[model samples]
Target chain A: DVKVTQSSRYLVKRTGEKVFLECVQDMDHENMFWYRQDPGLGLRLIYFSYDVKMKEKGDIPEGYSVSREKKERFSLILESASTNQTSMYLCASSYRREDYYGYTFGSGTRLTVV
Target chain B: AQSVTQPDIHITVSEGASLELRCNYSYGATPYLFWYVQSPGQGLQLLLKYFSGDTLVQGIKGFEAEFKRSQSSFNLRKPSVHWSDAAEYFCAVGSSASKIIFGSGTRLSIRP
Candidate 1:
């Protein structure tokens, strides 16, 4: 089975502080993604990486950035965390863009900014 | 760009009863559609996906969904509901780009 591991399951940060959420997938998937899940909003993509050192912004990438130094690892960085940024963050990986290979997501990290 | 919409925000059903969840999409051509289930505080799990071929697609946990091109609807169905099935379900549409758009999601609750 493919396992996606998240660095922290829960986190707390003060407003204006920097935050980092990490994800690692055992599978050799090429595509990696970072998303934030909010109630009544579903899952919104923040950033995605197609290969090592390649990153792209998604629907909601205003206050967020991502790093993919390695193919198996993807990290989401909140430059300046705010109360509104407190939400559940998810990481996903896929084999390709058009292929039927489904997304394997991490357990997710629930961040609370005070 | 492809987008998805799940009309039902919350649904309640009794155990052993049939279940249906509605999903709609907006796309110019046939878009790849998927259904995912998420337990509280967990990641989304793939339930099923429809890329082409047969309109009706079978999925895990005895669940299925039919793709209606005319109406642009892909509704999920199950013969019998289980208490363990109570969770948030999301419908997504994948485009040619490397991104997939997800719906607002529907919260399902099973009554014993």
Candidate 2:
């Protein structure tokens, strides 16, 4: 079965700490995305990469950055974690420009910044 | 800008009851519609999707959705819902482009 795997299921960090959330997909998909899900707000896109090393900001990319150095790996970075950044982060991948194919998502990482 | 709307924040239905979850979208041109379900602490799973051809699409787990371009809505339905079907449902819209916009989601609870 194809899968998008997230490195951590849960993480707790102190304020001002740097954080890294990693995602890896085995499907060889061309598009990778990062989204933060909050209660009542559903999921908001943080960033997405169409190709390796190419990243685009999403609806809420203010406190986040991303790295896609390899085809199968995409990493979301938090420059300085704040309490407001605490939320569930999900990573997803899909075929390029083919929204009809839908997306395969990771189990997600719940980050808590204290 | 593309957007999706799931009006109900939460819904409670009895087991073996027929179910329907509402979804609305706003997008330019033809839109690709999708329905996904997320169990507790699990990733979202694709329930169904509508791109072209038939307006009604069948999905896994006895779920179906109909695409209504005139109303800009894609509503999901099931003849009978099971206890295992209790989960959060998300409606999403996308174009031929690379991004998809998701709705706030509707949490479904099954009653005995």
Candidate 3:
């Protein structure tokens, strides 16, 4: 079955450390997104890419950046980790056509910043 | 601004009983509506979606949702809920754009 794979399921990083969370999709989807899931807040979009080397900021894009070097790979970067940044990070992918079909998500990477 | 609202933060229901989770949306036009379930420590799975045509849509695991344009609501219902159905349900709305707005989510707990 097709899937979105996140490289890490859990991670602990120190404050002020640079962190990288990787995601890869096998479905050849053109759109990829990163969202942070928090209790009582649900999931909030951080960034999304519609094509390679292209990215757009979502509702909550502060303290985050993204890279799409290849069509199948999208990476989320934390310039400097903070305690507030600790949350369940989810990666998802979908077709270029908007809302034609729902997104396929990765198992998610829960990060903790100390 | 487009947004989704799942008013109930938590719901408890006995197994083998009927279930309903409410969801409402506010958008400029007829939007794409979806219901997603996230089991403990798992990714969100699409329960069902409504784009157009029939207002009522069937989804996996015997779940269904009905779209009421006049009410701007798309509520999920199940004839009977199982123990395995305990999970967090999120309601979402999407426009013709790339992003989808998700509600805060409702956590469902099944009682014995």
Candidate 4:
């Protein structure tokens, strides 16, 4: 079975602190994505990378950034964590331009900024 | 822009009862549709997907979804429900081959 592993399932950070959430996929997929899910709002995309060192901002990329240094690893970064940045973060991966095939998702990181 | 709507916020059914979850999408052309299930504290799992071909698509775990072009709907159904079937279901639409839009999700509850 394909696996997408997230580095942390729960995290608490102080305001203004830099935070990182890591994701790794074993499927050798070329598309990686970061999304923040909230009650009533569902999941909103933050950022996505289609290839190594390539990134694109999604609808809600204001407070987040992403890094795809290697093919398997994609990282989401919070420049300075704030209370509003706290949410369940999900990472997903898929084949290049193959959204129809769907994405394999990680267990998700629930981040809380105090 | 592509969007998905899951009108039912929550639904309850008795075990062994029939079940249906409604999903609607808005797009100019036929879009990629998907249904995913997420158990409490677990990651999302793909239940099924519809790309093309037959409007009726069967999926894992005895779940099926029928695509209605006229209605712009892709509704999931199962002949019988199980206690273990309680989970949150999300309907998603993909306008392009790169990005997907997800609905708010419907939480399913099963009773004995």
Candidate 5:
């Protein structure tokens, strides 16, 4: 079974603090993604990594950065956490394929920026 | 760029009633489609997917979806609704490895 693990289930941080959301996958998938889910906006992509040390910006990547130093791990970094960044963050991983087989997502981390 | 649209933001159904959630996608070519359900405070789970061949696909937890090429839609349906089926459903379209889009999502509410 494929398991994606997110380090934190819930987090509270003060404004302007640096926040790190970590994710790890056991499936050895080549693609990993970070997304933030909001009520009306839905799940918007923050960043994605196709391979180790390679990263791509998603639709909403301005306030976030990502690191994939290892294949099994992907970390999302908030340079300066703000109250607007408070939301449920999700991590997903999938095999590189022409046909989408869907992603294995981790239990999201609900971050509260005060 | 690929995009998805879920028309309904929320739906309410009584237990044992039939339910359907609408989803539409816009892509240049034949696209990969998927339906995912996320329980409150949990991760999203794959409900179903459509690649090719059969337009109708069955998934976990008694959920199924149909791919309509002409309509550019992939709607999820269930014959009967259960209380545990209450969750947020998202429809997604994948055009390429880097070009996948998810709909805003439809929140389902079940009443007894």
Candidate 6:
């Protein structure tokens, strides 16, 4: 079975601290994405990577940055964690535009900024 | 830019009742649409997708969605609701390279 695993299922960080949430997929998909899910706002995209070392900002990328150092690994970074940053973060991966396979998501990481 | 709207924030239904979840989208041309379900503490799962073909698309977990070009809608439906079907549903419209805009989502409640 295809699997997408996040580095931490639950994480707590202090305000103004640097935080990183990691994701790795076993499907060899070319596209990976990071989204923050809130109850009313749904899932807002933070960043996405189409290739190693390349990235693009999404709708809500202002408070986040991402890294794609390897094909299977994608990371979300918060330069300075704030209380408002507490939310459920999800990672997803899929093939290039040519394929029909939909995105596969990781279990998600609930980050709490204290 | 493509976008989706799920008007209903939550829907409550009986365990054996029929169910329909509404979804609307806005796009310049013919768009690829998708429906996904997320269970408690689980990742999102694709329930169905509509690209082209018959307007009605069938999917896993006894789910079906109808595409209406005139209305720009893709509404998901089920003959009967199951307790396990209680979850959050999201509708999205896909752009090139799999870029998509998703709706806020609708949370379903199945009352036993």
Q: If scored against the real structure, what TM-score would every candidate get?
A: 0.98, 0.98, 0.98, 0.98, 0.97, 0.97
- lDDT tens digits, residue span A1-114, model 1: 888999999999999998989999997888999999999999999999999999998989999989999999999999999999999999999987666657989999999999
Q: For candidate 6, what is the DockQ-based docking class?
A: medium
Put down candidate 2 lDDT per residue, B1-112, tens digits, no spaces. Answer: 8889999999999999999999999998989889999999998999998889999999999999999999999999999999999999999998853788889999999999
Per-residue error (Å), model 3, residue A111 = 0.3
Tens-place lDDT per residue, model 5, B32-105, is: 89899999999999898888899999999999999999999999999999999999999998876455678999
Candidate 6 chain A: minimum summed lDDT over ten consecutive residues — where?
Answer: A94-103
Show pairs that collide, candidate 5: none
lDDT for predicted candidate 5 compared with the true structure: 0.92
**Model 2 CA deviation exceeding 4 Å by range:** none
Native interface contacts kept by each candidate, as a fraction = 0.63, 0.74, 0.58, 0.60, 0.61, 0.47
Best by DockQ: 2
Q: What is the C-alpha RMSD of each candidate to the true structure, in Å?
A: 1.0, 1.0, 0.9, 1.0, 1.1, 1.0
Each prediction's Cα lDDT score?
A: 0.92, 0.94, 0.94, 0.92, 0.92, 0.91
Q: After superposition, how far is residue A84 of candidate 5 from its true place, in Å?
A: 1.0
lDDT tens digits, residue span A5-89, model 5: 9999999999999999999999889899999999988889999989999999999999899999999999999999999999999
Candidate 3: TM-score, chain B only: 0.98
Residue lDDT tens for model 3, B49-92: 88899999999999999999999999999999999999999999
Residue A32 displacement (Å), model 2: 0.3
B1-112 in candidate 4: lDDT tens per residue?
A: 7888999999999999999999999988879999999998777899999998999999999999999999999999999999999999999998654798999999999999
Which runs in model 5 stand beyond 4 Å of their true positions? Answer: A97-99
Candidate 2 chain A worst ten-residue window by lDDT: A95-104
